[model samples]
Target: MFITIEGIEGCGKSTLMEKLANSLRSAGRTVIMAREPGGTSLGDRLRAIFLDSTLRIEPWAEAMLVNTSRAQLLKEVIRPALERREDIVCDRFTDSTIAYQGYGRGLALGPLEQLCDLATAGLRPDLTLFLDISVAFSRARVVGRANRQDRMDSQSDAYHERVREGYRSIAQGNPQRVKTLDGSLGASELLQAALVEISVATQ
Candidate 1:
């Protein structure tokens, strides 16, 4: 199963993903942890360019680069592991393109979705956990971080607000497959919720 974690910046996708991966590993499931625009040799280079704040990338161009990385990662890492019956935990996937490029960057959703389908060869997550959080709170978490801001993280609060709304809309549109979670919850609660949801879905 391809399980993805999605959200606006600093919504705890990465941190929670680590714990999720650990939990899955403890259960003796073969797991592959994939970070999008990464998890492959070509993707590593693309990630550097994609996340460089100094680079000015048009929305369409940004989407293309991201999908390119995704295509490579899927080919090199995700697909191979899945063939081995490994459960893949992806940090981000197609939904990020829809939210960031479509809503936040003002691209047409229909065309972008089509483009995504082409990029991914129609691969979809079996279960998606969307970490829902307020734009203000999510932005503050990004600002408070010691790490340098990436291009996406450095986006305007207004832009992030649109992205956040886009994620909610996606979750609403696909409630059965995409579970919306309150990102503001404590770590224990979040983990418990995740475990329960995963259990129900995978069972």
Candidate 2:
């Protein structure tokens, strides 16, 4: 299964994906954990550039850069892992581009969707977990972060709100493949909920 987790920055995507990967491993599944704008040598470099808070990237440029990384990650990591019958859990996928660049950045969704399809070669996640949180919660969590904030994390509250809404819209549009989870839940609860959803989906 190619499982992707999506949400606004600081919505606990990393924590949830880690727990899911560990759970899958405990069940004797070969799991590959990946993050978008990453998961390969070239992707990591692009990730650094994308998150360099000092740099200014236009919306379309940001979209293309991420797709470039995605193309590399698919060729080097995700597609091969799937070929080996391993379960892959990714922190973000093509949907992030649609939400961030299309909705949040105010780009055309049609072009963004086409770009994603081209970049990924029609690949889509078998399951997508959308962690839903309010803009207020996101702002509080991002502001409380102890580490250096990435460019996405440093976006304005309104931008984060649009991204969050974008995620919700995506979930609504893909009811069978996308599951919405409350980001305010406890860690254990969230993990269990995700497990249940995975169980149902894969059954």
Candidate 3:
């Protein structure tokens, strides 16, 4: 199974992804946890450049960089793991490009979608968990983080709002594959809800 978690910065995706991976492992499944703009040597290098807050990357340049990472990740990590019958839990995936660049960066959505298709070679997640949160909550969470903020984290509230709405639109368009979860819920509650969604989808 391929599962991708999608949300804006500070929406608790990494936390939830960790719990989800552990839950699946406890259930006797061999799980491979991965993150976008990463998951391979080349991907990691690209990730550093892509996420560096100091770099002023153009919208198209950002799109190309992430897809380069995605393509490498799929070729080097994701596909081979699936071939071994292991479950893959990813922190972010193609939908992120659509939301971040297409919506937040004011790029054309149609081409972005096509670019994602080309990058992934038409591969789509079996299930997606969208953690829904307010723009204010997202900002608050990002502000409270102890680690260095990335490029996406440094974007304006208006940009994040557009990205959040883009996620909503993506969920609405792909309801069967995208499950919306309340980001405001307690961690344990959110994990249970996500497990339930995965259970039903995999059945």
Candidate 4:
């Protein structure tokens, strides 16, 4: 099973992913946890270039860099895990490229999706968990937690709003595979809800 957790910045995706992986491990499932844009060494270098707020790159360039990192990560880590039939939990996936570049930057989704599909070699998560949270709340959380913001996190409010809406659109289009969760809830509650969703999806 390949599960991905996605949302806007500071939407508790990492926290929830950790909790879910821990629970699955306790239940005797061998889980492999990874994150996009930096899952492998080559991906990490690409991530640095992509996320450096001071570096100004073209939107299309940014999108392609992410795809490059994704391609390396998928080839080195994700595909191998899936081949071993390991249960994988990822922090973000291709949906992030669609939201961040396609919606946030007003780029072309058609090309972005096509690039991502090629990069990932048609790998898609069995289930995607969208942590639904307001843009304002997400920004506040991110600002309070991070001393310095990344390029995406440093974007304007409108960009973040578009990203949030992009996530919603993706969830709506794939209701059977994407589960939306309220990110405002407490950690334990969110974990419970996610576990329920995972159980149902796997069953």
Candidate 4: 10-residue stretch with minimal lDDT: 146-155
**Per-residue C-alpha lDDT of model 4 across residues 119-142, encoded as one tens digit per residue:** 888888999999999988888899
* Deviation of model 1 at 60, angstroms: 0.2
Q: Estimate the lDDT of model 2.
A: 0.92
**Model 4 lDDT at residue 34:** 88
Candidate 4, lDDT over the whole model: 0.90
Please provide, for model 3 over 57-99, each residue's C-alpha lDDT reduced to its tens digit, 9 standing for 90 to 100. Answer: 9999999999999999999889999999999999999999999
Using lDDT as the yardstick, the better of models 3 and 4 is: 3
Global fold similarity of model 4 (TM-score): 0.97
Which parts of model 3 have CA positions greater than 4 angstroms off? none
Better candidate by TM-score, 2 or 4: 2
Looking at candidate 3, the ten consecutive residues that score lowest on lDDT are 148-157
lDDT of each: 0.91, 0.92, 0.94, 0.90
lDDT score, candidate 4, position 191:
97
Which of 2 and 4 is ahead in lDDT?
A: 2
**Model 1 CA deviation exceeding 4 Å by range:** none
lDDT of 2 at 82: 99
Using all chains and alpha carbons, the TM-scores for the candidates as numbered come to 0.97, 0.98, 0.98, 0.97
